[model samples]
Target chain A: MKILILGAGGMIGRKLTAALLRKGDLSGQAIQSMTLADVVKTDAPASAIPLHTVAADLSAPGVAAELIAERPDVVFHLAAIVSGEAEADFEKGYRINLDGTRELFEAVRRVHGADGYRPRVVFTSSVAVFGQPLPPVVPETQVLAPLSSYGTQKAIGELLLADYSRRGFMDGIGIRLPTIVIRPGQPNKAASGFFSGILREPLAGLPATLPVGDDVRHWFASPRRAVEFVLRAAEVDTSGLGVRRTLDMPGLSATVGEAIEALRRAAGDEAVALIRREPDPAVQRIIESWPEAFDPQRARALGFEADASFDEIIRRHLEDEAPATTVRS
Target chain B: MKILILGAGGMIGRKLTAALLRKGDLSGQAIQSMTLADVVKTDAPASAIPLHTVAADLSAPGVAAELIAERPDVVFHLAAIVSGEAEADFEKGYRINLDGTRELFEAVRRVHGADGYRPRVVFTSSVAVFGQPLPPVVPETQVLAPLSSYGTQKAIGELLLADYSRRGFMDGIGIRLPTIVIRPGQPNKAASGFFSGILREPLAGLPATLPVGDDVRHWFASPRRAVEFVLRAAEVDTSGLGVRRTLDMPGLSATVGEAIEALRRAAGDEAVALIRREPDPAVQRIIESWPEAFDPQRARALGFEADASFDEIIRRHLEDEAPATTVRS
Candidate 1:
C-alpha cells in the first residue's frame, strides 16, 4: 500500500510516520512506498521502504493536484494552522484551513473522475468546533456553533467531507480530536499550550507557568492516542456513519487540580512544585467558554478508546519522551 | 432606508416586495430606493418608492461587487436552486449557493473595510439543514446533518454567515425557513411541490397527485409568514443572538392526512375527490428523511408565531391566492 501524509513535519505527523514505519503494514497489507509533504522540507526517514518528501503549500493553486499525482492508496490530511494563529490571520486561516482542504478533495475527485481510483482520506478536526453553553458531557448529536474562526473552518470542513463522501466523489472520514495533553515539544504561544507546558516542563525539571486556576476542566487525550485514532479512522468501515461522517473521539476529562495531583504521583512534590500559578484573566476567560467534556458515544461504539485517567496520560508522556529515565523511579 | 433583494423574481420575493411597498418603510426609516436582482429580468413594482431591477447571475465574478456598489442598507438574500435541481447538478449548486453567497459576504466585507458601511444581511436558510432519525419536535440546538445537496449548501451558507457576522464584517441573521406551503405560480418539478400542489390544485378546481402517504408529517410556514419572518429577522435587536446567528423559524407541523382533512373542510367532498394517491417510492424515500416537527422555543420566545392549525393555513392560502372567490360559505 502506498501512503501519503500531509503536514508531515509536525510532531504528530513525525510520530505517525514513525508508527507507520514500525508497523510496516496496515491490517496485513504490505507497505510499498510513502510520501510526506509539508510547508518545510522533511528529511527521508531511515527505512528500506522508498520514501519521498516534498515541501509544498497545499493552499497554493495546483499544489494539491501535484502532491496527489502518484495516487496514494490512503491520504492522512492533518494539516492546519493552530487556533491562535488562525484567529489572528483571518484570510490565512480560511485560505489554508478551508480552501486548502477543498483543493485536496477536488484533486482526489478529479483523480476518480479520470480513472476509477478511490483512496480513503482521513481528516483531522478539533474539539474547538464546539463552543460555549456546552453540556457537562456534550452528546454526539449536539449542534456545532463554533465561537472561533478556527472552529468555524473545521465545522465547514466536516460538512464538506460528508457531502463529498455522499456524492461518491471520494472516501472521506473526519475525526474531531480532543485537546492533546502532554504534547511532546517546546511550548509555543497557543492559549492551550499551557495544558502540555505544565506537564512537559515539570517532567524535565523546568518550571512552567500556569495561566488558569486548578478548577479549569477540559477534554483531552494523549498525542499517542490521537495518532492511533487517526490510523484507526482510516481503516474503519464507515457505512454506518450515515449522513454525518464526522466522529468526535473519546478522551480523558479532568480538571487542572486532577492533572497536578497526577503529576505529583508520578514525579513527587518536586514536579508539582515546578508549576507556578500565575493567573491570567485573558486565558481563563477563553478556556471558560470551551467544552469541558463530551459523551462521544458514537466514537466509543465504533471501538475508539481514551486514556483511563490523567495519571495514565502523564505516564505515557514519560514513556514516549524520555524512556531512559523513568519519572516514577 | 435603501433596500436590495437578490431574488426579486421568485414568488416570495414578489410578495416581500409588495409587503415592503405596503409598509413604505422599515422600522422608522424611510425607503429612499430599492434594487431587485435575479437571474432573469425583474419587472419594477408600481410603488411610489424608487425601484431599480438588475438581471444578472450573482455567482459570476465581479457581479456581487457590482451589486454592492450602490451599498443598500438592508440586503435580503433569498436566492438558491431548489433541492431537485441542486441534486441533479452538483457544480451549479455549489457555485450558485455556496460560492455566490461567499462572494456576497466578501463584497460586503470589502465595503465595510473601505468605509464604515455595515448592512443588515438577512440570509434565507432552510430546515433541510436537519435530516432523519429526528426528534418529535427538533430543538433550536439540533445539529445540522443535511441529506440533500441543497441542504448541504444552505448549511454551509449558515456557517459562513455566522462567521462573517462574528468578525464584524456585516450585521447578519440567518432564518432557517420551514417548507413554504401554498407556493404560488406554476408547479415545477420539486419533490416537495406536492405539499403545496395537493392543496393549491384542488382550490383551483384541478386534480393533484399525492406521492407520499397521508401519515407523513412535516413542518411548514405560509409564504406570507415566511416573508414576515424575514422582515422581523431584519429589524430585531440581534444583540441577544450572540455568535450563533441562525434561527429556526416557528411553523405549523401537521400530517399530510391533517392537511387533506383541512382541505376537505374548506372545499367539501367534491374537491377532496380531486386528490389522486399515486405512490412514488423515490419521492416517499426522500420525504421520509425530512424533519417532521420543531420546538422552535428560541423563535417563539423572540416573538415569532406559528400558524394555529391546518385550517388557518388553508384559509390563508385561499385569502392570499384568490380572496374574491370563497372556498367555504
Candidate 2:
C-alpha cells in the first residue's frame, strides 16, 4: 500500500513517517511506497522500500492537484502553522491552514470526479478547536468554540472534511489530538510547547522553566501514541463515524506537579531539580483557558490508547532516545 | 441615530426600517441618516432621514470600509446568500458570508484602533449553524456541527464577532434566528421557505404546495418577531453574554399538520384548502437533517419572546396583513 504524509518535516510527522517505514504490514496490506511533502524537503529514511520526497508550498493554487496526481490510497495531512504564529498573522494562518486544506480536498475531489478515485484521508486536528466556557472534561459532543484563529481554521477544516466525505469524494477521519507531551525536538511557536518543554528539557539535564503554576492540569498523550492514533484511524472501518466527523483521541490527564514527580522517578532527582518554577501570568491565562481533560469514550471504543501512567510516558521517551540507559532515581 | 442596514432589500431589513421609522420616539435620538446596501438598491421607506443607497456587493474588498466610513451608530448587518445558493456556489458563499463578515469586522476594528469608535454590530445568524447528531432539544451548550457550507460560514462569523467583541474592538451580538415562518414575500431559494410559503400563499388566496411530510418538525418565528429579536439584540445589555458568543432565539415548534390547522383557524378552511400536499423526498431529507426544536433558555432569560403556539403565530401574521378578518371556520 502507498501512503503520502504532508508536513513530514515536523516532529510528529517525522516520527509518523518513521513508524510507517518500520512497519512491515498495515491492515494486512504489505507496505510498499511512501511519499513525504512539506515546504522544506523531507529527509528520507535508509530503508529498502521506495520513498519519494517532494518540497512544495501547498498554498499555491495548483500544488494540491499536482500532489494528488500520485493518487495514494492514504493521505496523512498534518500541515499547519503553530497557534502563536497563527494568532499573530491572521492572513497567513487562513491562507495555509484553511485555504491550503481546502485546496487539497478539492484536488482529491477533482481526481475522484474524473475517474472515481477516493482515498482515506487522516487529518490531524487539535484540541484548540475547543475554547472557554468549557466543561472540565470535554466530550465529543462539545460544540467547537475556538477563541484563536488557529482553532477557528482547524474547526473549519473539520467542516470541509465532513462535507467532502459525505459527498463521497473521499473517506475522511479527523483526529483531535491532545497536547503531545515529551515532544522530542526544539520547541515551536505553539503556546502549549512549554508544557512539553518543561518536562523534556529538565529530563535532558537542561534548565527548563515552567510558565504556569504546578496545579495547572492538562490533557496530553505521548508523541508515539499520537502517531499510533493517526495510523489506527487510517486503518479503522469508518462506517461507524456516521456523520459526526471528528473524534477526540484518548489521552492521559496530569498536572505539572504530577509530571515532575514522574520525571523524578523515571529520570533522576537531579533531572527533576533542573526544572525552574517561574510563573508568567500571561501564559498561565492562556493555559488556564484550555480544557483540563477530555472524555474520549468514542475514541477509546474505537481502540485508541494512551500511556498507562506518566512514568510509562517518560520511560518510553528515554527508551526511544537512550535505549542503553537504565537510570535509577 | 444614523442606521446602516446591510442587505436592506431582505424581508426583515425592509420591515425593521419601517418599524424604526414608524416609531416617533427613538430615545430622543432622531434617525438622522440611513445607508442602505445590497446586491440591488433597496426601495427604502419614504422618510425625511437622508437616505444613501449603494448597490455595492459586500463580497468585494474595500466595500466594508466604505460602509463603516458612513459612521452609523447602529449597523444592522443582515447580508448573506441563502443555504441553497451557498451550497451550490461554495466560493461565493465563503466570499460573502465569511470573508465579507471578516472585512466588515476588520473595518470596524480599524476605525476603532484609532480613537475607540465602537459601533453596535447586530449580525443575523441562523439555526442552519446547528446540524445532525443533535439532542431532541438543543441547548446553548450543544456544540455547533454544521453539515453545510452556509452553516459553517455563519458559525465562523459568530466566532469573529465574539473575538472582536472580547477584544473591545466593537460591541456585537449574534442572534441565531429560527426560520421566519409566514415570511411576507415570494418564495426564495431557502429550503425552509416552503414552511412559510405553505401558510402565506394560502392566506393570500393562492395555491401553496407542501414539499415535505406533515411529520417534519421545525422551529418557527414570525418575521415580526424576527425584527423584534434583532432590535432587542441591538439595544439589550450584552455584558451577560460570555465567551459562548451566539444565542439561539426563542421560537415555537410545530409540525406541518399543526401549522395547517393554525392556518385554518386564522384564515378559514377555504385558505387551508388552497394548500396542496406534494411530497418531495429530496426536500424531506434536507428537513429531516435539521433539529426539530431548540431549548433556547439563554435567549428567554435575556428577554426574547416567541409565539405561544402556531395559532398565535398565524393570528399575528393575519392581524398584520389582513386586520379586518371577521370569519373563523
Candidate 3:
C-alpha cells in the first residue's frame, strides 16, 4: 500500500512516518511507496521503500492536484494552523485551514472522477471543535459549536469530509483528537501548549509557568495514542459510520493538580518544584472554554483506545523525550 | 433603517421586502433605503422609499464587495440553492451556499475594518442541519450531523456566522427555519416540497400526490411567521447569545394525517379527497432522515414564536395564499 501524509514535517507527522516505516505495511497491504508533503521539506530516514518528500502548500491552486497524482492508497490530512495563531490572523487561518482542506478534498475527488481512484482519507480534527457551555461529559452527539477560529475551521472540515464521503468522492474518516499532553519540542502558538509545557519542562529540570488554577480540568491523550488513532482510522470499515463520518477520540480526563502529582511520582520533588504559578487570565479563560471530558462511546465501539491514566501519560512523555538527559523524573 | 436583502427575487424575500415597505420602519427607525439583490432582476412596486435592485450572484467574485459597498445597516441574506439541487450538484452547492456566505461575511468584516461599518446580518438556516439518527425532540444542543450537501453547506454557514459575530466583525443571527409549509407557489425540487404540495394543490382544486405515509411527521412554520422571525432576529439583544449565535426557530410539529385533517377543516372533505396516496420510498427515506420536532427553548426565550397548532398553520396559509382562490371545501 502506498501512503501520503500531509503536515509530514510536524511532530506527530514525523512519528507517524517512522511508525509506518517500521511496520512495512498497512491493513495487510505491503508498503509500496510513501509521499510526504507540507509547506516545508519534511525530514525522514532513508529507507529501501520509495519515500518522496515535497514542499508545497495545499491552499495554493493546483498544488493539491500534483500531490493527488501519486494515487496513495491512504491520505492522512493533519496540516492546520494552531488555535492562538488562527484566532489572531483571521484571513490566514481560513486560507490555510478552510480553503486548503477543501482544495485537498476537491483534488482527491477529481482523481476519483478520472478512473474511480478511491483512497481512504483520515482527517485530524480537534476537541477545540467543542467549546464553552458544555456538558460535564460530552458525547459524540454534542454540537460542533467551536468558540475559536481554529475550531471553526476544523468543524467546517468535518462537514466537508462527511459530505464528500457520502457522495462517494472518497472514503473519509475524521478523528477529533483530545489535546496532546506532553507534546515534544518548543512551544508553539496553540493556546493549549501550556498543558504540555508544565509537565515537559518540569521533567527536563527547567522552569515552566502554570496559567490556570489546579481545578481547571481538560481531556488529553499521548502523542503516541493520537498517531495510533490516525492509523486505526485508516483500517476501520467506514460503511458503519453512516451519515456522521467523524468520531470523538477517547481521552484521559485530569486536572492540573493530578498532573502535578503524576510528575512528582515520576521525577521526585526536585523536578516537581520547577513548575511556577503565574495566573494569566487570558490563558485561563481559553483553557476553561475547552471540553473537560468526553464520553467517546462511538470511538470505543470502533476500537480506538487511550492511555490509562495521567501517570501513564507523564511516563510516556519521559520515555519518548528524556532518553539522554537521564533526569529519571 | 437601511435594509439590504439578498435573494430578494424569491418567495420569502418578496414578502419580506413588502413587509418592510408596509411597516416603513424596523425597530422604530424609519426606512431610508432598500437594496434588493438576486440572480435575476426582482420586480418591486414603485414606492416613496428609495429602492435599488441589482442582478448579482453572491458566489461570483467581486459581487459581494459591490453589495457591501452600500453599507446597509441591516443585511438580510436569504439566498441559497434548495436541498435537492444542492444534493444533485455538489460544486454549485458549495460555490453558492458555503463560499458565497463566507465571501459576504468577509466583505462585511473588511468594511468594518475600514470605517467600523458593522451591520446586523440575519441569515436563514434550515432544519436540514439536523439529520438522523435523531432524538425524539431535538434541542438547541443537538449535533450538526446534516445528511445532505445542502444541510452541510447550511451548517458550515452557521459556524461562520457565529465566528464572525464572536470576532465583532458583524452582529449576526442565524435562524434555522422550519419547512415553510403550504409554501406559496409552484412546487420546487426540494424533497420537502411534497409537505406543502399535498396541501397547496388540493386546496386550489388541483390534485396533489402524497409521496409518504400519514405517520411521517416533521416541523412546520407559516411564511408569515418565517418573515417575522427574520425581523425579530434583527431586533433581539444578542448580548445573551454568547458562544452559540444560531438558533432553532420555533415550529409546530404534526403528521401528514393531521395536515390532511386541517385541510379538511379549512376546505372540507372534497379538498381532502383530491389528495392521492402514492407511496414513494425514495422520498419516504428522505423524510425519515429529517427532524420530527424540536424543543426550541432558546428561540422561544428570545421571544420567537410559532403557529399554535397544525390548524393554525393551515389557517395562516389560507389567509395568505388562498385569499384570491377562495375555496371553502
Candidate 4:
C-alpha cells in the first residue's frame, strides 16, 4: 500500500510516519511507497520503501494538484492551522484550513473523475467542533456549534468530506479527535496546551502551570492512541458510515484532579509537586466553553479504543518520552 | 432603511422585496433605497423609493465587493442552486451556494474592518439541512447531516454566517425555511415540487400527479409565511441568538392525506378531485429522505410564526394567487 501524510512534520504526524515505517505495511499490504507533504519539508526517515518528502502550501493555487498527482492509496490529511493561530489570523486560518482542505478534496475528485481512482482519505477533525450549551456528556447527536474560527473550519471540512464521499469522488472517513493529552513536545500558547503540559512537564522533571481548577474536566487521549485512531479510520469498513462520514473518536474523560492523581501515582509526589497553581482566568473561561465528555457510541462500536485511564495516559507519556526514568507504581 | 436582496429574481426574494416596498419601513426605520441583484436582472417593481436592479453572479470575483460597496442596512441572501440542480451538478452548486455566500461574508468583513459597517444579514437556509435517521420532530439541537449537495452548501453557509456574526463582522441570522407549499408558479422538477403541485395545480383547475402515498409526511410553510420569517429575521433582536445564529423556522407538519383533505375544505371536493394517484417510486424514495417535522423552539420564542394549519395554508394561496375566484369556508 502507498500512503501520503499531510502535516507529516508535526508531532503526531512524525510519530505516525515512524509507526508506518516501523510496521512497513498498512491494512495488511506492504508499504510500497509514501509521500509526506507539509509547508516545510519533513525529514526523511530511514525506510526500505520509496519515500518522498515535499514542501507544499496546500492553499496555494496549484500546490494541491501537484502533491496529489502521485495519488497514494491512502491519504492521511492532518494539516491545519492550529486553533490559536486560526483565531488570531482569520484570513490565514480560512486559507489554510478551509480552502486548503477543499483544494485537496477537489484535486482528488478530479482524479477520481478521470479514472475512478477513489483512495481512502482519512481526515482529522477535532472535538472543538462541539461548543457552548453543551451537555455534561455530549451525545453523538449533538449539533455542531463551533465557538471558534478553528472549530468552524474543522466542522466545515467534516461536511465537505462527507459530501465528497457520498458523491463517489472518494472513500473518506473523518475522525473528530479529542484534546490529545501528554502531547510529546515543548509547551505552546494554546489554551488547552496546559492539559498536556501539566502531565508532560511533570514527567520530564520540569514545572508546569495549572490554569484551571482541579475539578475542571475535559476529554482526552494520549498521542499514541490518537495515532491508533487514525490508522483504524483508514482501515475501517466505511459501508457502515452512510453519508455521516465523521465519527467522534473515543476518548478518556477525566478531571484535572484525576489526571494529577494519576501523575502522582506514576512519578511520585515529587513529580506532582512541579504543578504550580497560577490560574489564568482567560484560559479557564476559554476551556469552560469546550466539551468535557462525549458519548461517542459510533466510534466505540467501530472498535476504536482510548487510553484505559488517566493512569495509563501518564504511563504511556513516561514510556515514550523518558524511558530510563519511567517509574510504575 | 437601505435594503439589498441578492436573489431578487427568485420567488421568495421577489415576494420579500414587494413586502418591504409595501411596508415602506423595516425595524421602524423609513424606507430609503433598495438594491436587487441576481444572475438575471430582476423586473423592477413599481416603487417610490430609489430601487436599483442589477444582474450579478455572487460567486464571481469582485461581484460581492461591488454589491456591498453601497453597504445596505439589511441584506437578504436568498440565492442558491436548487437541490435537484445542485445534486446533478456538484461544482456549480458549491460555487453558487458555498463560495458565493463566503465571498459575501468576506466582503462584509472587509467593509466592517474599515468602518464598522456591520449589516443585519438575513440568510435563508433550509430544512434540507436535516436528513434521514431523523427524529419525529427534529429539534433545535438536531445535528446538520445534510443528505444532498445543496443542503451541504446551505449548512456551510450557516456556519460562515454564525462565525462572521460572532466575530462582529456582521449581524447575521439564518432561518431554515420548510418546504414551501402552494408555491405560486408553474410546477418545477424539484423532488419536493409535488408538495406544492398537488395543491397549486388543483387550485388552478388542472390535474396534478401524486407520486407518493398519502401518509408520506413532510414539513411545510406557505410562501407568505416564508416571507414573514425572512422579514422577522431581518428585524428580530439578534442579541439573544448568541453564536448559534440559525433558527429552524416553524412549519406545519402534515401528510399528503392531510393536504388533500385541506384542499377539499378550501376549494371544495371539486379541487380535491383533480388529484391523480401516480406513484413514481423514484420521487417517493427521494421525498422519504426529507424531514417530516421540526421542533423549532428558538424560532417560536423569537416570534417567527407558521401558517396555523394546512387549511390556512391553502386559504392563503387562494388569497394571494386567485383572490377573484376565492371561496371562503
Pick by DockQ: which candidate is best? 3
Compared with the real two-chain complex, what DockQ does model 4 have?
0.85
Real contacts recovered, all predictions: 0.69, 0.55, 0.98, 0.79
- Worst 10-residue lDDT window for candidate 4 chain B reads B320-329
Per-prediction DockQ: 0.78, 0.53, 0.91, 0.85
lDDT of 4 by residue, B1-329 (tens): 88999999999999998999999999999989999999999789998999999999999999999999998999999998999899999999999999999999999999999999999999999988876688888878888899999989999999999999999999999999999988998999888888899998888889999999999999999999999999999999999998789999999999999999988887788888999999999999988888898888989999989888998998888888876465644
Which of candidates 1 and 4 is the stronger one according to TM-score? 4
lDDT per residue (tens digit) for residues A52-74 in model 2: 99997788979999999999889
Global fold similarity of model 4 (TM-score):
0.99
* Top candidate by lDDT: 4
lDDT of each: 0.89, 0.84, 0.90, 0.91
- The residue-level lDDT of candidate 3 at A125 comes to 95
Which residue runs of candidate 2 sit more than 4 Å off their true CA positions? A24-33, A187-191, A211-214, B24-29, B106-118, B167-169, B187-190, B205-216, B269-285, B326-329
Backbone clashes for every candidate come to 1, 1, 2, 0
Q: Write the per-residue lDDT of candidate 3 for residues A1-329, one digit (tens) a residue.
A: 98999999988889899889988999999999999888999776788889999998999999999999988899999998877789889989999999999999999999999999989999999888887689999977898899989999999999999999999999999999999988998866667888899888878778998889999999999998998998899899898898899999999999999989888888888877898999999989878888989998889999999889888998788777777454452
Of the candidates numbered 2 and 4, which has the greater lDDT value?
A: 4
Tens digit of lDDT per residue, candidate 3, span B162-273? 9999999999999999989879899777788888898899878899999999999999999999999998998898989987899999998899999999889888889899
* Candidate 4 regions with alpha-carbon error over 4 angstroms: B326-329
Among all candidates shown, the one with the greatest TM-score: 4
